[model samples]
Target: MEKNAPCTTVCPTKALKQDEVTRVVTHSTDLCIGCWACSMVCNYGVIGRQKEARVAVKCDLCPGREIPACVEACPTNALVFLEVKKLSGVKRTEAALKLARGMQGKAL
Candidate 1:
């Protein structure tokens, strides 16, 4: 999750908080007052509204589940669940591979 997303910061009821261990942003529906403050400030547009309940909704990473249902149900594997450090390592490896390929047969 974003280190300091506006949605988390603007939540008046403190319903949204980031898990220090998982780094995942969690939402407490009980604490939510449907103020829409979090939704308004969400830059990623991930926050949604429950019209009937008047409560804001968002992916909470399926607490207590190994993988979120959304990620598991994705047909094309477009949605992936990875830890922050693992994702960073994957990106770094990709960059290194690309750089190595580009430097092939090209001397300093």
Candidate 2:
């Protein structure tokens, strides 16, 4: 992230990572408060809070499901379930711009 990047994720240690270094995010389902921090904070928006799961879970992008949850739920057709390596240059630019804007008045 740039120096102006926003601290949108409000975790105790700001446990957000840049890319899917882990490919999948696994956490204790019982401990999640469904805060939607992963959804709000991630530039790629790989994670989201689901009422059905009662916790935040990141995308596995597994087959058999027609679309990922975010892509399916996006009303404006914003979210796309694209393979990370196949993501277009434009999408990456847009994500970076949005994250910079989110930084706004934050000091760090």
TM-score of the candidate numbered 1?
0.65
For candidate 1, what is the lDDT? 0.85
Clashes of each: 0, 0
lDDT of 2 by residue, 38-101 (tens): 5676666556667885677754544357787768988998777665556677678989999999
lDDT of 2 at 107: 100
Per-candidate RMSD vs. true structure? 4.0, 11.6
* Model 2 misplacement above 4 A: 1-24, 61-86, 89-108
Residue pair clashes in candidate 1: none
| Cα displacement (Å) at residue 17, model 1 | 1.2
Query: Best candidate per TM-score, number?
Result: 1
Q: What is the lDDT of candidate 2?
A: 0.58
